[model samples]
Target: MPKQTNVRCPNCGIQFAAPVETVIDVSQNPNGKMLLLAGSLNAFQCPNCGSPVRVTTPFLFHDGSKELLMVYVPPELNLPKPEREKAIGDLMRELTAILPQGSFKSYMFQPREALTLQGMVDTILQADGVTPEMMQQQRDRLSVLESLLGAPEETRPSIIEQNDAKIDTQFMQTLSLLIQRMAAEGQTEVAQQLAIVQEDVLAFSSFGQTLMRDAQEQEAVMQEVAESIQALGAQPVRADFLSLAQRYAGDDQRLEALVGLIRPAFDYAFFQDLTAAIGKAPADEREKLETLRDRLLELTQAVDAQTQAVIADAAKLLQVFASAPDEQALDGLIRENVAVLDEAFLSVLLANLQQAESQGKSDLVAKLTDIYERVLGVLREQMPPVLRFVNELLGAPTPEEQQKMLDENAKAFGESLLTTIDAVSEAMSARGEDSIIERLAELRAAAEQALA
Candidate 1:
């Protein structure tokens, strides 16, 4: 029976042994020599320090020293440069003979590795008096590798050690090949692969876009703060400006100028909304309507509710801190309901006015006129901003109109077409020129048919 031994790491008192495909040389010993065998014995690896432990095996010797079973191999087990060169030459000749006749001439030689292999061969040829035999050996080795590339993936072992690294490299290689094929033949499958790769890139791009948008918003806030400080000399700074500055403190420096402008715009807008609510015209006699005037008293409460609702929804969607139910939105909802009631009240007032006029009640008519004039005066004070707000809301474009804006930009459309062309070109490099031309012709035909 053959004697067995275990391998352990000499350092850190750990054991580390595994059967790797590659073997090592270990012939530099003072006593004799040794070979680092991969799978002759059980190799142990230390869990703590990851050291290889060595063990000895009892050799069939008559009362002699025991032989070390597990050996440590050094590097450079392969042939020297001269011998290796000779071997490579022989390999190339063998490869050439195995290839189908005229394989080089008839086939356009779509070697994906052509550039790399050729560069290596060029470096070799730069040396003086290198014979064809030497070149042939290199070709043989590469030919073998090419065959492996063509083989089914499951049959070939992955050469890369790390799973993540291997996967990423394979994906990139696959994508390059796919793109080349698409360019040459415009295959639908190739296009689909390109789309998948694009989706992955876009996922990363969205993060950058979000960062940019946030930066812009913050910059706007800061600008407003700076302007206010300059104007008021920073004594008892306005409450609104202070809040705006604090909110955008973490934003980019460029935002300081924009921040100043943004707050004034918002303030002006708020007042505009207020005036519009007060000054809105009464609805038609027949059609009762919730005119802006009815919302004048509770306008601020409504806006507060709207703000809280927007914030809560955003937080919920972002999966951040839980946004509790806000009383502000509730207040706004109440104000809207009150406006509905006011419309009905106006209708009743109009009815009472008609009744008094029909009965010739002069005193009652005069009292009703006074109330009507007072209401009109209040409406006049608020009319400008209220109508402006209403106009802005109604005048805003629908989704369809926004889409049209994107579609109609001539420069953008041209740029998009250019992008598609670039994608096609990138894919074509992997595929052959003939294939690409053929595919383009097919596409042209299809387009003509569709037009017809």
Candidate 2:
């Protein structure tokens, strides 16, 4: 992701700033294509008039799997040769730095420069074998998707049924992609609508049934593999795993999928059992077992390396957290890693905090506590303020006291606050605290009536 920056809107001739990605390496960020499809990567809407603006700043797009390396430069800018080369050189450095070494091909050194934003987008689609006919079909699918989404509730289903030709496996996938993007950008309402439409498509379309069946079969394969392991006693040997693999190896993809699903189980003792079995097996059987071991090794090593990289990064983050001299800086670092503030990271952080507390690092404990607050504060955005006020009103010891407090804080009640209340309610429901969710609704209703 490139830094958010200012750009001139050609439609309205207004200057606005937005997040503009300049170097999109799909190998690094797999969602780059969705961003491109959603027209968000270089998309900026004019602030003054809400007109669409394509900020065709220089960008280097890459997808290693497709052998795609394309760049875009605004013709209007007419940048000098030396300046263009310098920009390209810097982008090349940034791209290569993120990618695996020697993955760069000679074609990459001469990225095809796009004259227009559509041209850049077309270049990417073409890399994925999207022929002109396919491109037109995609555009048609997009138009139908918009029509169904924008249609009135009573007519939406009819529109969907009429254009059943438009709704395909690819159409549902496109909707899924858009939903992912919307949710990521905090456009929850749009994401929710798209999700409903996607479900309708899945329930009504023919290709949807085929897709669903395929997914079910894939899931069942893993589930059967998991269940079959029960036949192996609590302490199963390498022989047990080999039997399981032999049962599934008829379909290699299924075998790999099973391996991936049960990857965590392939720890030290599991390998030790396999090694022992290899030693005991006769020549032909031993060779077969050895190959199976190698296959598992290949699969597990690939995944484990990725996990190890995350763990290592988490470890480094903990180190940074430990070294923060003040609470504010600690909060800053925590905010930067909100998406990665997951179980793996939080568990590691807890271990670090425990060490700090055990070592009499009271100051560090206070900072960690602040970090925890900020982490929750992300989910807790606009939540705690309203929730706290509601609680205070609820427990003011009397109805009169509650009313008095509500009167004093009347300025804080608005649609924005109501939206936050609903948001918090959703969060509380997701967390399975329905009891509190009921209270939230009651509080919001009271606030809404009072404001009315």
Candidate 3:
């Protein structure tokens, strides 16, 4: 839990309450660890002048996985020796009191002191296997990004061309993370500027262009394979999948897409059937079938591995939310990690919620439910206004209710609401969602009349 402390803004002199995090436990509060690494922990913008202010106070950093305990006190604080020692002792006592019994180790008593925040960050990164060279490289990339962001809009292309070599996968990833962080902090103008820089980087840099091209090709492959599977009808049997696999035998991307899209269909029984068919195949066809079988085995293994990794990451993130000390902290974590709140994460949350309910863990079930709703709320807030309105209209229970909603919001949405309804109706129709399509059609009529 953060301590709300009165902070006087240097720029405006107006005082405000800021949540100051004095202790970061990596095992429990991973989100705090992330914010600390991002250099935004205890950072706030003044309400009066909107100037960034950072709280400089003594804090304890603990990572149980690494068996690391460290303490940092801002040098600028200039506390007397005894006062500093007492502050450190207080933080240590607070940490030890909350830790599980018998889990305290010797390192907790004699916490290592970091002379500076950078030194503390470096030590943490080093423990995570980030070498000094890697750190320098990251710093270089960050410098280049800063230069790009600082340059004039018209000059960005040339700047990117000059520093194209520094613009690699890690650089782009860092830029993306910065954008997300800025947006989460409500710095919309800065986030928008960073977004423009990202587009220019993707446009001008060599690696960025390659990434763009690969993304396009992958999207095309996904669409083609999705259409193929859709053509397989509602109930595609094992033989149907086998035939589909053989059709795209040598095309690794399409084969990968096929396997990823319908991984469950390629079970042990399906593979056994394939082996049987391969054994009975003619000599000319046997080699091709065998090759396809080998390739599919590799693809399935890769897909399963990737899925497991995603699930593990999702579970870890969910645990962070569950361990949040308060609703405010949980909401902040959700907003900070919003970019990763995808179907896989939601599925994991749902499964956990179901298990808690079944096991009669009412408290856990309630917590998970709150997290789930908050996650969905954040996601909806990110959607376009039209889509959000459509979602609200759909949530109305009956035609009368939907019609009432449409009437209330018609002036605001105008004809755009009718257009969105039509688009959604078409999409739902294609997916064979008859009930939804019917409701959308009626709503579309009502909306059109309302707008008219």
Candidate 4:
């Protein structure tokens, strides 16, 4: 829980009441932990002028799992020595009062002190496995990014060329994360600027070019492998997968794509059959088959490992959401982690929902359903207007309903709706979603007629 504190906005010179978080317990209040890490805890936008205001006060940080306890008091407050000691004592008492009996430890009595907010944040991140060196490197990358963004458009290419060595994979990932965070925080202009900077980096940096090429090639390989699997008919057996593996034996990318697309097909029986085939092959061909088997096994293991990592991360995020105390807290969590509320997280949430339904947990089901709807609402709001309109049209069950939606939005969408429909139809055709492609074709005709 946050303490309501009166704060004066520096820009507006108006005072307002704001919720100021004083205690951040990771296990009990993960939202506070997240906001603190994001550097937004106790930060508020002035109601009158929307200027950012930060409240600095003494606070206690505790992570029971890590056995870490610390307290921070801003030196700018300039309280007397006795008063500072009294404030710290008061915060410590507050922390202990909320904690369960018998959970108190020696460390709680002698809490570590953090002189600065950054120092506290660094300590928290270090506890989570991020080393000081990694933090410094991230800071350096951010510095480079800022320099690039601040450079004139005509000079950006030169700046990128100079910093090309620094703009590696991790730098690109950092930039991407910043873009997503900015967008999630509703800093549209900043996000758009960062996006332009990303494009500039991609255009001028050598590593970026290689990454783009690899992504394009991987997509092409996946599409080709998808077509091959589709050609195997509705029911592809172990033998069919084995044949596909053999066909893509020398091409590592294709083999990886094939295994990724049909991972469940490469079970024990499939491997055993491959081993048997390897044993029966001619002496000269046996080595090749054995190598193919080894490669398939490696690909399957890698795919499984990657999938498990994704699911584990999603599950952890879901736990954070479940631990949120109320709707407002959950909403804050959703906004903070919107970048990671991807398909994997949604799948995990849906699985939990189903399990709760099967167990007849009506309260949990309702809560989870509300979370699902809220997440979808936020995602829909983030979509481009044209895309959102198309999605709404698709959700309509019947032609009449779809037509009614189209009619209502036809003037708003204008000619762009038909163009968007054509684009979606092409994408659906490439993915071999025949039914969706057909429906998109119908939507396009109706849209064109309406717009005409």
Best by TM-score: 4
RMSD of each: 36.9, 10.4, 4.5, 4.2
The parts of candidate 1 lying over 4 Å away from their true place are: 1-162, 166-187, 197-246, 251-452
TM-score to true structure, per model: 0.15, 0.49, 0.80, 0.81
Alpha-carbon local distance difference test for all models = 0.35, 0.70, 0.86, 0.84
Q: How many clashes in each candidate?
A: 48, 0, 0, 0
Give the alpha carbon lDDT tens digit for every residue of 156-251 in model 2: 767777888777767877788777555444445676788888877776676777778988887676566656765576687655776677566446
Find the 10 residues in a row with the least total lDDT in model 4.
43-52
lDDT of 3 at 349: 100
A best-first ranking of the candidates according to their TM-score comes to 4, 3, 2, 1
Give the per-residue lDDT digits (tens) of candidate 4, residues 250-316: 8998998888777889999999999999888899999888889888889999999999999998988
Residue ranges of candidate 4 with Cα displaced over 4 Å: 1-57, 62-69, 75-83, 90-109, 123-136, 151-155, 404-437, 448-452
Best by lDDT: 3
Candidate 1, lDDT over the whole model: 0.35
Model 3, range 1-452, lDDT digits (tens) per residue? Answer: 67767788887799877667898887767768888898778876665665667788899999988999999999999999999999999999989877888999877779999998989999999999999999999999989888988999999999999998888889999999998777665465788899999999999999999999999899789878878888999888999998899899899999988898788989999999999999999989999999999999999999899999999999999997898777655765676677789989999999999999999999999999999999999888666589899998889878788888878887798878878888888667545577999888877877888888
